[model samples]
Target: MTFQSTTSGIWIPLITPFKAGELDESSLRRLVKHYSSIGLRGFVLAATTGEGQTLDDAELERLASVCADETSHCSCEMPIYLGVSGSDPRKVEKRFQQTKHWPIDGYLISGPNYLRPSQDGVKRHYEFLAGSTERPIMIYNIPYRTGVNVLNETMLELAALPNIVGLKDCCGSPEQSYDLLRCAPKDFSVLTGEDPFFYNAMVHGAKGAILTGAHVLAHVHLEICEDLHNGHQKLALEKWNRVVHIPRLLFVEPSPAPVKHWLWRQGLIDSPEVRLPMLPIGDSLAGKIDAAVNLQGGTDWRI
Candidate 1:
């Protein structure tokens, strides 16, 4: 079959479920099914939320294998996209060169972070990366972390490339996003990378989102997307409001750290372990996260 995204609703930026400083394949299996049972569409393995920056090629491959195996067998027919990128174009190129042979459905590549390439450079970077791989590409633009913005003009230019199929727009600007939606060709999907804008993105014509917050509330989030597509606008808005603060909550203490805390409490993984420079949520933040979780009716709020 030709490569296509089955991503629309609740495509979890899945947390890397580890234990005893090793890959927990069992937890990976259980996690996929847990979301699948809740009607989540797919898995975004090894993305930023999965700590892609810290994972080696072998580890990514193993996680991809587990996700693919589990997703294919699950009732949801979920597709898995492997996220890969770095500040160095050459380093990211090397990664694309290395993993081009893997079985993932596609690659979700972010703009070069820190170095902050110019607009033309960003386009060229994606051009070269897409040229290097057979996998379809989804350009990720999250300026908050990346320090570079893939403006709508650049996005339109990149959309013309055959292999460049979609974008993860986290530039955090609704005006730019709406303009892209108005101008972008239908097949060139515009998926939001901003978790808070999930419902609005869908309502305003975004195809979908790549959300880290969905890891805990995948079912509800996916239902919101489905509700909009099915013309249930009121219902979609209501569902969207239910956890809009989730992005802020999960992001308050650096990504994946807060998310890890929630997952650990749910018995989905072991200790809420994060790599160096990213420690566990402190007591104050923990209390805040707990309150947010409780407010959202999430029973898994311990830290």
Candidate 2:
């Protein structure tokens, strides 16, 4: 399927589940089934939320294939997008070529991290990768993480490429986001990666979001998008006000830690175990997540 068709809606950046220090295939399958049943438009496997950096190529490919198979069997047949990143253009290109046979619909490729390449270099890097893949590519512009931002001018230039279909806009600059939203081609989608800014971004013309926080209260986030699409401005703002604290709570201890804890509590996964360098949520945050879930009317509070 084309990227434009999958760009506009709530896309979950799935968390990698581990059991006894290995990929939890059962939990991963169950998670995909649950989310796909809930009206999610697509899935982004092994992204930052999925701990892509910590996973080996084989693990990443396995994760993608599992998600793709599960999604295809679901009632919705959701598209699965893989997340890939690297500092060396040659290595990144080669990796993409090697993984070309993986069962995925597209890729969410981030800019090089640490190297902090110039705009021209960033453009060249993306262009070279785009040239290597037949599948659609979504530019992941999270400057805070990558240490380099894909400026609006560079974004527009990339948008002109036939296969560079959209962006996961976590640039962290409202000015840059708004400019790209206004100037990007209609087919060049702009989906927010910032959970806190999901509502605001959609209101300002972002097609959708790839929020990690949605792993808990997903329907509430999906409803926010639905409300805006149906032109319920007042209702959308009200919903946004009610659930805006979710992102803060989820990020209180750094990503999927808090999210994984919540999912485990909901009986969606077996354990909340994350890899080394990333710890599980603490007791205090666990209480907060519990209270948050309760306040939202418990697990039954879904659309």
Candidate 3:
């Protein structure tokens, strides 16, 4: 199957909704409907924002299947991408091979987390993964998480690979992003995984954003990108202003926690449950998240 980038609008990295230490299929279904109704371009399951680290293989497969099932059930053909990454490049590539037959649209592979490979290593890592699978690959270069940055030249080199399609740029450096916009191939996508930079990224030629905030405000954030893309600069600016502070709040504690908190309040999930090594969000952070959710009017905020 040929997979093209759905290179515009809000692409929500879904949170794993759990119950009794098991995947909550019902809540998963509810979230699918909720986002689709609100006009999300697509859904990304089992990504960083989806709490992929805590899930088992059974759970991962179930998550992907449920998303595929729910999207079709709603008569919404939103594309679904699954996150595939790990510390070892070989292990990551093995996992990617495992998903070769899964019912997903694409793979969002982040750079190795702990090893912090050099630029040559980063390029070689992706080159290996890209060659291992025929699936379209979206490189996730989150230096904050990975401990190393995939620089522009390396990215352009990877972009030339036959299977490597684009990137989810969370380098947290606008300078790198600007350089990428100036240097990357026209077909190579440079979506901002950094929500705070979404508007600026769009203005500087980002294809779109794969944002954590999209879990809460999918429609508005997507519209912000779309408006900017379609030359509706004034309206895009207004929308951007409304959600500008969200990234800070969401990251105040750590990812998926604040996002899960918001989803819990909306009744989309059972608990704001995070696995060990990542405890439940603290009261202080929860309060701030609650305030933001309330401020945005409980997931029904007008874009």
Candidate 4:
């Protein structure tokens, strides 16, 4: 089946909702249903925002099934992309083979973590994956998390492969990100994974954003993308101003913790449970989030 391409617009790197140390299937369903009604274009499951590191294969499978099932009932097109990351090329390949047949449309894969391969090694790593599967793969160039930067030159080489579609760019350097956006192939996408970079990225010709903040304010995020897409820079910047201080609060602690806490407080999810090594937000951050939530009287905050 040919799934729709999610190369543009406000896509959510969805937060995995858990309750009492278990995957909350009901909340997962609710999230898909709710976000679909909003203007957000796509959903990325079990990724950085979804707490992919802590989940087991069984749970990952279940998460894909539930998200795909829920999205199936929506009137809008919400492509479900599963996240795959590892330090070893062979293991990542095996991992993709494990879940390739699941209900997801494609994979959001990161460069090898920790080992920090050279540009050549990164090139070969993605080359191997693109050759190993016909599934659409979005390169996740998050140098801070993955420890290796997939440079623009190497990325162009990988982008030549038919199945290696686009990128979730968190390369961390504004110069590098802008250069990639300017130099990337026409069919290749450069969607900023950094929520705070949305306006700037769009200004620099980024196709769109895959932001975690959209999980809380999809309408706000989507309006930003729409304005920019329609050449309404003033309106886009105005809408983006409302979110200038958001990423700081959302990422005050470790990610998804603060995002999960905000969702929990809004009653969108059952609990703000995060895995060990990834704790829930503390009182100070919680108080800040509460104040933000109180600003707009719910999840639709202007903060």
Candidate 5:
């Protein structure tokens, strides 16, 4: 169940399915089952798009366990990266200790959110966590949510670590992302966490992406990456142009809300329920997604 940066491509930070205020294990399992058939590089459980902040440890583990079970049945194994974030390094260390034996192949950890530590502090935070566990780590550099960007220099320093293999980059600065991508070591993969930036990142030699919008139009996303790899730039741009608006549309509301509604509308998930503080997509957005979904050819994505 080992995973490395070389094979990283189009990882989906799955939307956590919920039913009646409880973890919807049934829908969760079904989602994994369907995605396993897709040509995705991997799955990220309980990530930002998965509403990781709202999930308890037990709920999160169920996510990993179910995904693990479903992937085990597939001919090709799908690597599962569990998402965990904290404001303190020591607390993050404790999280490593807790999920150290989960079914996941590795971890996707975010920087100290809300606390907004200094660059040195942030570096030391990941330094401790990377050394805390033997499993590979994908540093989630989503400064907008975490409130502290991991600068390219600091990221390069972290990339030197053996376990810190890649980044879920959402630094919100194209210049910064390009700088890091150019400076990053060949082995240090850079996967954009910004859904709308996927094409730009790929064009900039990003290893891939951990996209939420990928929950819908996933095969199209996969194809765009393939086109880049196969040197079909023209084809890639054409495909990207056609669906580039989907990412922004999904975020018209607040993230996984629109994404969940899209999936629910497609019958990929039973419900589009997000936890408190994150509500379901409003009717207006739902209508837009519904029309877009129909325009995308009425589900049957797995058929």
Candidate 6:
């Protein structure tokens, strides 16, 4: 699909569920079904929120397959985008080759992490990958996590590529984001990856967001987007007021831990299990999440 048509709205960076130290296919399917029913525009499987680094290649394949299969059964088929990131150009290219036939609509690839390449190298990195894959690519420019930022000039250059459709803008610089938004091609989308900045980004003309916090109270996020799209700035801000603390609360610890705990409390997943090097939520935070859920009236919150 072209980026112009499919890149907007709230896309959930899914959390991979684990049971007994194995991929929890059942819970994965359930989470997809629940979100699909609530009207999420797309899914980003095995992304950072899903603990992509912790998953082996085969596990990533399974995660993609389960999401694709389940989403197909939804009343509205939501697009699925698989997340792939690394510092090695060859290895990253091989990832595209490996998952080339997987059931997915596109790819969410991040800037090279750790080794922090120059802006020119980063541009070449995506140029090489874009040449390697026929699928549309959403450039993920998360400097905080990847240790390098895709400067506005580099981003505009990458946006010119036919296959490089949009961006998951986490560059962490409002000035850079504004410059790109002002100059990016009309067809090239710029979706914010920073959860706390979702509403702010929308006001600044972000197409949408790939939010980890949207895993809970997703419809509220969707409504905020709709209000903005319809020019209901007042209504959107009012809606945002109700859930602005979500991202802050969810990220109070390390990510998916707090999110998974919230999902477990809502019984959306069987267990709040994360892989090694990532643990479950703490008791204090769990209590806060519980209080949040209670205040929102749990899963019965109006969609």
Q: List model 3 lDDT by residue over 209-254, tens digit each.
A: 7888888767777677667767999999988787788878888887
Instruction: Give the worst 10-residue stretch by lDDT in candidate 6.
Output: 294-303
TM-score of 5: 0.96
Candidate 6 achieves a global lDDT of: 0.88
Which pairs clash in the backbone of model 3? none
Candidate 4 has its poorest 10 consecutive residues by lDDT at: 1-10
**What are the models' TM-scores?**
0.90, 0.96, 0.92, 0.95, 0.96, 0.96
**lDDT per residue (tens digit) for residues 11-96 in model 6:** 89999999999999888888888888887889998889999999998999999888888888888858889988889989988888
RMSD of 3: 2.7
lDDT of 6 at 78: 87
Report the Cα lDDT for residue 66, model 3.
Answer: 86
In model 1, the worst 10-residue window by lDDT is 1-10
| Candidate 5 lDDT tens digits, 1-303 | 334643378888988999999998888888888888888888988888988989888988888888899889987668888888888778888888888788988889988899878899999999998889998899998887888999999999999998998999999999999999898888888999888898989999999988888888789888998899999999999999999999999889887899888888888788889998998787888899999989987764332
Candidate achieving higher lDDT, 1 or 4: 4
Clashes of each: 0, 0, 0, 0, 0, 0
Misplaced by over 4 Å in model 6 are 300-303
Against the reference, the lDDT scores of all candidates come to 0.78, 0.87, 0.80, 0.85, 0.87, 0.88
User: Residue by residue across 1-303, what tens digits does model 2's lDDT show?
Assistant: 566877778889999999899999989988988898999888898889999888997898889888888888877758888888888879988877878788888889999999999999999999998888888899999989989999999999999998898999999998889988998899998999998988889899998888998787688888888888899989989988987888899999988899998887777788889998899888999999988766765553111
lDDT for residue 228 in candidate 5, whole number 0-100? 93
Considering lDDT, which of the candidate structures 2 and 3 is the better prediction for this target?
2
As a TM-score, model 6 comes out at 0.96
Q: What is the lDDT of residue 25 in candidate 3?
A: 85
RMSD of 1: 2.7
State model 5's lDDT.
0.87
